[model samples]
Target chain A: MKKRSALIIIFTLIVGLSGLSSKTFAETAKNNYRLYCSQCHGLTGNGEGIDKPTMGVAPKIHNNAEEMIKLKDADIYTVTAQGGASVTKSALMPPWEGVMSEAEIKDMVKYLRELCNCTEK
Target chain B: MKMTKLTCLILFSLALTLPVRIAAAGDGKTIIEKNNCGTCHKMEGPAAKTFAEALSRKAPDLFYAGSKFQEEFLVEFSQKPYQIRPAGTLYLNHVKTVDGVDRIQDPPLCASRLSKEDAVLASKYLMTLKDPDMKIGVYKPGASFFKIGAKMIFTKSVACIGCHQVKKRGKIVGGTSGSSLYNAGSRLNGDWLSSYIRNPHYWDPMSPMPKWDLGEHAWMQLTNYIMEMKE
Candidate 1:
């Protein structure tokens, strides 16, 4: 009976540990980008998406590596979570704090770094 | 004594009814109709349209304008006739109608801009567009299949709130010249909104608002966010 209980306890730990390690959560961040960001940012993070032609104001291009590298993780996170309003940017870019999760936001930060080929400072 | 009392009662009733009867003599709405407000305005939603069906296809449907606009906003815009957000690329189609094969423009020669008094009256009548019967369901997302997070991104950081309205904590506050999105959830279908966000020209050929640059999830979330605006 003692050995059986120990095994059950060990199994639960494994299950809980695996849940935290699952990379699936990170993937959703990309999906979030496709649905919300793609209209203005382009699918590949290049900045020239389908919505560009009609925009009264031009969206910034994310294609540059040096500039993308200079942006801190906090800056990107702030812009994403708080919106353009927080950073004195366009109000058209509404804040997403009410809509998105903190984890998803961090994942987006990492994904942007990958897309821009920039490393965190 | 009884006869004198009856005469006094009759005279008082006539005094009360005289002004009320004269005030109801003219229908302000009919005066607007005679001037041809229908040529450019629709007074009700597409669901139960009356008083004017011909005008719907000609101009921006005024059916929801009553609910969509504020008193001062409508009066000012009607008098000066400033450009509503330049129609996106779809402006071309708006200027001309596409038939089976041939396309034709239905441009109007008469200007619809109204005088201050008429604009006020028109605004008064137009602002009555609330339909207590129409209620949309709130968006509810169940368990998700993929990982999720809240971090959102914006393009080169333009100031969008300068003209457009967005919902914040069940309150509608923002700019006015652009169409009010106070009830966009009920006003726009999700698929149509998604496509429009990606390319406004795709749906509205003459829209002046530029295209946005967010990804699919971001777009969906934005739509979901807008959908939250309701009674």
Candidate 2:
């Protein structure tokens, strides 16, 4: 019984640490999103930002789950890190690799999934 | 009190000149305020409050006008207003879809042309409203060697090309969401450009552009690259 209790405590600690790490990462990504992407993409990921009208082409509406679901995770990552021009999309989406960390970019991808309410295929 | 005639003459002369100096210096400020230029422009302080307010702003922020504009250009522009932003200050308000393609309407007219005296006075007053924190001395003038690297930074690193027009291969190419930077070198002061790049929020709180954490070297190089773009 003593050994079983020790194992349970260890298990709880591991789970709690992992949860904290993910929550911290998610918060960082959300802050970065507000600072960088929210301007053109919008605070709610609706793509109806102040710059939307000025853009010759409308920004992708991230909240549209149907459209977001059609895109692969790799495609979204490429567009976010390398910019829209990398995939022959609009040149307006600037590459963010230099400005953000690899970890942050990955987390932002997760956040984007959350915004779309969809998961990677 | 017994005063020498020379002392009295000097005192009288000084009083006469003081009023003339004050009139010359204060005329511009009075003229600007009298015209109600603030109705369309923010002559001082931060930008609009909300996104909706930002979109509805009729004119550009004039808080940094003293730093941003060339005096000669301002004077002439005040007398004979011309289109600066091809899509107007709020492009969304002026955009219309035609055959599935977005078309920008003609820019709105500026307030009626001011008389020559008023234009000059207004320009002089406007030029005095500069941002002191805008560091212009860090940038060396006419340094065009960094064009190759700066172009990469502008296009790939920061994606400024997405919204601003820049000259490439002897042709203009870029997004039109922001004003075309093709003539920025001639149109805007390098100092104002650097300050704007450093912190756009300082001038306009509601500006849609994000705050970039670019170091001094990066921003100065970018400024040089922008200033080199003329015509």
Candidate 3:
């Protein structure tokens, strides 16, 4: 009976630790988004950042879950990492490969999914 | 005779110390601090934490002043400040409606003006805050490649023309969100421009400019194109 309780305790601790780590990851991703994307993408991902009005072309609204749901994760990652120009989109979304690490880029993609409340296919 | 000799020795010591005192009296850092320049300007890094704070920033980051500005320009501009960004640094905040017409507000005149002597000292001190990571001659594309770079800047790669005003067909064109790059060739150092283009946040953490992961060749070409935009 004690061994079983100990196993249960270890399982609970593992789950709790994982939950905490994911929360920290999300927080980091949010900070990164604020640093790099929020300037043009807006703090709420509504595509109404201060630079939006001044931009020659409007940035895509990330808050629109319906639209975001249709986009593939790979496509979104490509746009974020390689820039909009790589996919024949706006050049205003400059590449982040030089500025951010691959792990960070992946985190940003995951954050974007969370922002839109969409699940990967 | 002994009293006369003592007087001569005192005079010699005083003469030796006068020049040193005069030279050390006008320390630029002291003058900047005395004027409370840090209240408006960012002398160091790790930009504002929040968007509101970033938007509220009044003056440009001066940490890279050593690497970015020409000494003569710095000295002259400090004494007689002029508008560098026509749209103001935070242009979005300056937009206002006057008489049912929307217009961009004029930037405030630089409140801090230094005398010629103080300006020289300040400029000298500012020029010492160079980014040690930046090395010259990393990329030096020749005049022949300027046309290709111009094309890339306009349409192909990073669309700098989308935000910054550039000369096209003898007419200033492009967005007003950023500082006009029409005279960047004369106003900015090529090395500084290259570093800024590669990673703007390195110079100013709150920079709204997006990072471009252009290869060295591409960035070099863009740099050449920008430097060709002389007065």
TM-score of chain B of each: 0.41, 0.79, 0.76
Inter-residue clash pairs, candidate 2:
none
- Tens digits of lDDT, candidate 1, B113-230: 7788767766666655543433233223331322222113221233344335556676754433245556555555444454555555333322334555566666556556544454
lDDT of 2: 0.73
Candidate order, DockQ descending: 3, 2, 1
* Complex DockQ, candidate 2: 0.09
Candidate 1 chain A — worst ten consecutive residues by lDDT sum?
A: A19-28
Clashing pairs in 3: none
| lDDT digits (tens) for residues A1-121 of candidate 3 | 9999999999999988876431123337776776567546766777765456657788777778988988998998899988997898888888877656688788898999999898666
**Over 4 Å off, model 2:** A1-67, A70-91, A95-121, B1-22, B97-101, B167-172
lDDT of 2 by residue, B1-231 (tens): 356888899899999998865675489778878888888888777566544566668888888788888788788878898766666776666755455345566768778488898888888878878888776666567765577788877776666876676777888677555777887887788888888877776666545464566777889888898888776
Tens-place lDDT per residue, model 3, B1-231, is 999999999999999997765554348777778767788788896555445666678877787788887788778878888766655776655645445323457777666799988888887777877788887766463546757656766554677776677777899776555788888876777889988888886666556577765677777788888888877
Q: Which stretches of candidate 1 lie over 4 Å from their true place?
A: A1-27, B1-231
CAPRI classification of candidate 3? incorrect
Least accurate 10 contiguous residues by lDDT in model 3 chain B:
B95-104
